[model samples]
Target: MSVKGVTPIENTLEINWQGDQKSIYHNIWLRDNCHCSECYYPITKQRLLNSATIDINIKPKSVNVKEGKVEIVWDTDHSSTYDVDWLRIHSYNPRLIPLDKKLKDDDDVLKQKLWQVKDIKDDLPQVDYNKIMQSSDETDNEEAIKEWLLQIHKFGFSLINNVPISPTDTEKLCEKLNYIRPTHYGGFWDFTADLSKNDTAYTNFDISNHTDGTYWSNSPGLQLFHLLYHDGKGGTTSLVDSFKCAEILKAKYPESYEIFCKIPVPAHSAGEPKVCIQPDIPQPIFKLDHQGKLIQVRWNQSDRSTMDYWENPEDVIKFYKAIKNWVEIITSPENELWYQMKPGQCLIFDNWRIFHSRSEFTGQRRLCGAYFERDDFISRLKLLTLGREAVLDSI
Candidate 1:
């Protein structure tokens, strides 16, 4: 076992096993487990075998060390190799438990952080809705529109009632709101359009419990729907707070929370301009903010790809079952608030924070809607807050 040039560095340990020399750095054991697709399968939820799986019968054909890498040719028939970093980690720690354990623990911490709500009220400033609306007829009204936008930001959404009802007036209202956040997507839906038409843009049919733009890489944050004509039929809209749903999950199934936080489930759209492919981001179905306030829940059963990264298979199944149970609880009659928008009334809502659905209608129900970016709402809120401070100083 006399290996040539066998020299161990001051802080490193060198080992020569059957002509193969491996240098072990002091911190090699704590190296981050590379989150590569080959290393971790997002769908199978299994970690590939580490260096302990190396064949003992194989003898190194050649061993070379350069830079920070140890290159070796294992037996002519092996036909493959290993990286120095990988070898160092594998050799130093035969049991690959810490990386995965740390990931799971970090997930727990993130879940805790997400469930706690951040106090944003102190950071928000007040604005005058009437002043802002009046300015809409005057100057460009950038200042006024910014103030109205702040109200929407503070309330998550707002209802503008008492506006005169007319198809032409509805179009003007949308145009005015457009100044707040230019509608990335805009359309009008009525009874005439086949309610049965299964399209994302216009859905006249009775919708299910779902969020809009789950397929988008960054879904539209806000949605404004104006009721131009309501025949007073059975088309009432229902809303449920997603944060409330998260709270129910945290209280009901703690183990399921642990599993979801560890697993990385694929959520993507199969259409053109592929939306998002986020990795094991370690998010729970329900998360609380820093102040122990419920924040949001990432729920969409239809978009769930696979739950292979979960170390515990049984736990993964339990987590999904818990999600279904939570959905049932939130959508129950008691939890949902139903409101029918009258003609000339507008409803704006945070698409991310609230889940909305409409009941099947009997008569013609016409409505116009537009979407806005989340960041745009934040920007308008900030500007309005600053402007309000300036006005207060002038007083």
Candidate 2:
């Protein structure tokens, strides 16, 4: 294709193309898929797309393709002409392809996001353990605590040791952690003798590999737990990097990955005063992070019984089986890090990215749990550093 002249008249692009009449103008396509902040949200976070108001009807008026360059004119009076070379670089086909399928020019964005969790190393910000340890009893260390929490914000999780062992202390620790309990009970999973003893009030059985609070319309983003009494017996906490698990599944079972991407799993909780029913979250078991890195995995077999109801029952079965196997591979001792929480130690993790569970304990063991909205942490960090909250809510 050859372009004779290229010019931007006002906001419209003027382009001449010398190609078969059947060939759709390429510049027009580029204008429609512009990824610029003006065309789309600056932060292309998956959740942000729901809030975006895009003008999908807008189209380009004309296009011209020359030996080396192409020009595009927009139909809107205020639109701008774009160069063909630039258009080609940013164009993307909107067709929903399976996570395993590679689009024409896009790299596996999901894979790229997934691998980021594995590759994160020293580049992540760190908290000064000494400073936190030296804080006095009288001074308000909220500033210091905010600094420590910011490190956890940068890293998916962080650990603190030597907290005073008391229920009051546990509550205070959660407050310092900026805990924003879910409006519903979705955020807190109480591990108390009262709840555990009452089988009807709480399900005290062993929990399988899964993320928490999937039944909530808006699940808590961060989970915090403080060990009040370990008694030095059992109940070691185990955490698996869900992102790593996702990539392993994607590589080993491409068919299962495709099945999960296509199927919608139902998640709900019933027989309670506050019951929750979520019909289809439209989320991949694995998802890419803000930087286009895959770092989140949402899988809970107990809540996944709805998978069998999918239109493609066989595919759902295959996906369930694949995920079951994948969970086993990822949660194995070799792939996970297990830490026995001494009395008074606390653990906090990103709910969306990490899957945590504990081995059954024989004797009495107690732990206090709390959760904070994702934006709370972000706001705390921004306020600590910028002296004011960014006001940008919702991750």
Candidate 3:
């Protein structure tokens, strides 16, 4: 973390660490990140100096390692000091390929531990409700909440044991991040397996494993479902880590994987008598970030709209084949994990990464659940898990 030396390049600053390791920081990046009280506000974690005002070609008059800090005197007569640890964490080496750019921000995405059914069958991440909600100390509660949420970030889903079997308790859990996201289904909602709506979810038939809200451009990021009551048999909840399935596809069927990643498929939900819901534009089944790392999985075969928008029948066939390949991976025994939710058990999952399903049942199954917006949940996680400086940098 201690800087051994600093060398000012033409448009960058190179730092040699205590060991043989070295890193390069762009001149503009350094200037924009000058975290001094004059240039940045600690409380808001916002830059007081506008980035657009900084010259693109600005150079440093002198760069030195002083008192374990990188001190830079810019040609503009402004000076900035950077802690070596922050500089090291924010270093860039200009990787060209998408795969090589995966670690650009040392965020949760980089630390994800992808897994299949075997990894979670017995040891599914679960937390005690009392620990998170009834802790006497605020720090203890914060740590408990972080533990409850970090599970979803790392493995895509988690279970809360002994959550009060009340509809409002589910809303309370959702509020741990911020607030429940409202959909066509009401906010802070509860539903029973009755002919309440037009969707098949109102029936007793088995539901396939799929991520919800594929029809929306910006789908809900997190989903919580608590089984408030299940008087009859079956209705075991099933979950699959689509991220893990995707990795297998990348290794086994690269061509098909690429098709899923590139081809946009339209989806819709016209079950409601008065309203029709669909994304503004079609979206790829396998969504990836610029780094070529998978971010979300949109897989709802039943919600897929007709292919009239796609003119090429050959392309349509290829898309079907790609989808079939992905389906095979997710349906495999080793990929699916099933659990029977009791009245007091609540499940929270990252909708972007996990596919959830339900088994056929005879009796009425009452459920209460809510959705958490993607950015809110992620920011909450970062606030709980990452250092203030790192969180501020991301902001």
Candidate 4:
């Protein structure tokens, strides 16, 4: 879109954008976002302008529309060039809807492809280890690694076959891309079913499908579970796409979904000294971004603490009913996808979307795993690919 006209005011700049729509931008905002060489470094694509040093009352000395751009000479003697297309995308006039809001309102923004057992049973995002882990050439390896990460971003989970049967393999794998998320449990951890630890994950009991670290405000994003050895009778990993189940709730039972979206549930670690557990963290089961898109799911029955928050008795009852229905839907037969993780196989899944559990087993079953922070994973994806657009395009 091209700029039709430009007008400089005392504190704001008004642009007559394409379609005869007017967009107003603050003078300070435009100055901070200047694309000039002095204000921004194009090589690193980073802004050099310091907001703290900027004059809050700065205004444009002269503004003119030329060659499809708004040329501005600031009162501070700094000249900047802004493409009309950039202004169109960054418009904040109340009369004109924001570009992102317009896209989302139009249902043009893509969402993750939620799947159940039957939908992706035969077509799981399974990749051969050699393509991602053992490519000889640097260019080939980068491409393969990008493909592997893309699979996780698109499907929320991926299986890499033929991984080395070592606990350190998970660590090495993290280093290949970025760093493994280090939390209270450390950067990398290995565990086996035993009563020595208080956590249910330590015992050979039928662990319910749950996401990890609901106790933390920012839960872990991606989880890496690599079975090093399993001489066990059973321990099949059960996965449920919580997002998929949530979509069902939203479509079929809108009231229950609304309750889940509104209410916050308490999750706790119960102060276990082993992992330095901190308790009583509150989180909503279904989280939505500011744009009203389902961004994450946090549900762990065992980790959930009592909801003692003061509320009307009727509302409390409604919460209980909604949670009960939510549990039933998530645990439904058709939603679960079970797989027996064998040695030399690593299952990388989006912890925010996939709820995982372990079936009770006998004998020894050892697993090594690690967590990757949500922002880190997203940053890596964007650096390697198209960031949010990559996900939108994939869906």
Q: On a 0 to 100 scale, what is the lDDT of residue 344 in model 2?
A: 60
Alpha-carbon shift of residue 210 in model 2 (angstroms)? 1.9
lDDT per residue as tens, model 3, 85-178: 6666566674222222333445444377789877778788999987877643355458778787789888898899988888887677677657
| Candidate 1 per-residue lDDT over residues 69-146, each given as its tens digit | 454443443322334434433454232222222122233311221111223223323343344456653465576666
Candidate 2 TM-score to native: 0.60
Candidate 3 residues lying further than 4 Å off, grouped into runs, are: 94-110, 136-140, 310-313, 393-395
Write candidate 2's Cα lDDT for 156-188 as tens digits. 567766677766665666666676585444445
Cα deviation at 246, candidate 1, in Å, is 1.8
In model 1, state the lDDT of residue 368: 66
Instruction: Report, for every candidate in turn, its global Cα lDDT versus the true structure.
Output: 0.52, 0.56, 0.82, 0.78
What is the lDDT for 113 in model 2?
28
Supply every candidate's count of residue pairs whose N, Cα or C atoms clash at under 3 angstroms.
15, 15, 0, 0
The model with the greater lDDT, 1 or 4, is 4
Q: Can you tell me which runs of candidate 1 are displaced by over 4 Å?
A: 1-132, 136-151, 166-197, 200-204, 257-296, 301-312, 386-395
Q: Estimate the lDDT of model 4.
A: 0.78
TM-score of 3: 0.87
What TM-score number comes out for model 4? 0.86
Q: For residue 8, what is the lDDT in candidate 4?
A: 77
> Over 4 Å off in model 2, which ranges?
1-147, 150-155, 186-191, 196-204, 271-282, 288-295, 379-395
**TM-scores of all candidate predictions against the true structure:** 0.53, 0.60, 0.87, 0.86
